[model samples]
Target: MRLTIDHRTTYRFTAPQGRVVQLLRMTPRNTHDQTVAAWDINIDCDARLREHRDGFGNITTMLYAEGPLSGIEISVSGEVVTSSSSGVLHGTFEPLPAALFLRSTPATHAEPALAAFAQAATVGRAPIAALHALNAAVHERFTLVDGRPEAGLTVTAAFARETATARDLAQMFVAAARAAGFPARYVTGYCDALPNGRPTPHGWADAWVEGLGWVGFDPTLGRSPEAHHVRVAVALDAAGCSPVAGSRLGEGREWLDVEVQVSGQD
Candidate 1:
């Protein structure tokens, strides 16, 4: 399948800021299962973007703009060709050892409850099967809410609510998979949505299979991803894979809006 993505993020503020800086992880890299045919990024305001690759191998863009500006927009458009790899990631350069992902971040910390849940979910299974079981268990246990969850909610917190956005669920899956002794990471990207409906950006978890390398699982969908998924950025936690993250020079209440549309062609 060939997929196209149009993602735009806009920021509006109550007062003008002196400057704004952002890190963009919106570009998709070519993998064995995915090929990037075209990609571009545009900013509505005056800014200089410097591109670099991060440790996790994600393509990062640094955006800097001097502003007495009230708003800014970042737009990303791209096309990719993807094929099913049975969830295994191959042919991409991975700079960090898989064990590095075993180290926990605050968002994915494995508390006793999470550890116990992981143990219960994967009892008597092989590593690959265990990951599949954990993925399905997470889907069965939690519901996908329509909107994003409140910011900064941890894996345990999402479990308490019994529902969360894809981002939170992916984070939970990362935490649980790590507790189960599998190195895991968070992936942010695009996926096909229902026909004629606007597609939103997606998030999922990837676990290192002893013989299979990294395999992706989407707890939100209760299955491993296939050709419909276009992977963009990956990291130990969601924040690191976020499409855009930034800070402003001036202090004022800011409102954010994001729009994403993903379509596919045979």
Candidate 2:
């Protein structure tokens, strides 16, 4: 299957800012299982960008802006073609390794609730069924409520409390996988193809099987990502795998707006 993706992020900072720097995880990685037919990341402003691969072999871009700037906008657009390989990533520069993923991060720490869930999960069943049970349980039992950030609460704790955003959902998925003895990792990317290349809603989770290696799962969709999914970065949490992470050397408050769009390969 083939997929096309376009993701754009807009930032508005108050007053004149001195320096701005952001790390962008925009490139669709080429993995042993997924092939990159064609991919390119375009930047609107004339700033500096440096490319680097993270510990997980995810392609990352470090960007910085200089001088008093009103706002900063970064847009990424690309296309990729993928073929199924028994859920194993092959024939690509980066293959999801076991070491990089198994390790826990701030957002992926396992708690008692997740451990108990993993213990109760129908392990003998197929991965899809198990994952479906997890998703359905999460969706049905918990209420998706919006509120201020939790007071230093981890994703597992949030699940116990029944509140989260798309990011928190991803975290919970990771913790559950870890509890199940799966070397799960967190992923961030675009969802359904939005019109005019507009950025759309997204979610992530862990994918590890006894023989299938690491795959992509969306608890939001309750299934492993097929052709519709366009993967960007994978880490232990939202902060670790954030598509954009950086700091702005400015005073007062700042505003940020992010948008994304993912489309199927034509």
Candidate 3:
């Protein structure tokens, strides 16, 4: 499948600022199951973009801009060809040991309730089957929301809620997987399964199975990622692989808006 993506993010500040700096993990890399055919990032204002790879091997870009400005926009367009990998990752960069992913971040801390739930969901099952059962359990337990996830929402809080965004679900999955004695990590990227588009990028979780290496599971979709999924960045939690993370030397308040479209063809 060939997929095309258009993503734009805009920020409006209540007061003028002096400077802005951002770290972006918006670019996808080539893996055995996926190939980047073309990609570009455009800034609406004058900014300097330096490209580098992060500790997780994600393609990252640093943007620095002089600002007395009220707003700025970041636009990304790309094309990628992907093949069905049955959710098992192949030929992808892995700098750190898989055990590192077992470490929990603030957002993915598994509280007692979540840990117990994981234990109950996967009990008496094999490793691979147990992961599938856990994924299905998560999907059945929460209603999936389609919009921006609440900032700084933790897995414990999201698990208590009746509904969850993709990010929240992914974080919850990571927490549960870790609690279940499986090394897991958060993933941020694109999926072309939506009818039109989404306000933000997609998210999922990957777990390290004994014989499978790293396998992708999307609790949001209750299935393993297929050809429609474009894998980008992976980290201990969403914040680590967040598409944009930065600070602006400004005052007052700021408003943000995001738009993402992903279309695929065979």
- Using TM-score as the measure, which candidate wins? 3
- Candidate 2 global TM-score: 0.83
What is the lDDT of every predicted structure here?
Answer: 0.89, 0.67, 0.92
Which residue pairs collide in model 3, if any?
none
Task: Sort all candidates by TM-score, best to worst.
Answer: 3, 1, 2
Among all candidates shown, the one with the greatest lDDT: 3
Per-residue lDDT of candidate 1, residues 1-266 (tens digit): 99989999999989999999989999888999999999999999899999999999999999999999899998999999999988888887799999999989988898899889999999899999999999999888876776655788888777778667888888999999999999999999999853243466789989999878999999988899999999999999998789888999998899998899888887
TM-score for each model: 0.97, 0.83, 0.97
Tens digit of lDDT per residue, candidate 3, span 1-266?
99999999999999997899999999999999999999999999999999999999999999999989788899999999999878999998999999999999998999999999999999999999999999999988998877788999999999999998889988999999999999999999999984343546999999999888999999988999999899889999999999999899989788999988888999
Where's the lowest-lDDT run of ten residues in candidate 1? 192-201
Off by over 4 Å in 2: 85-88, 92-100, 123-132, 143-153, 193-201
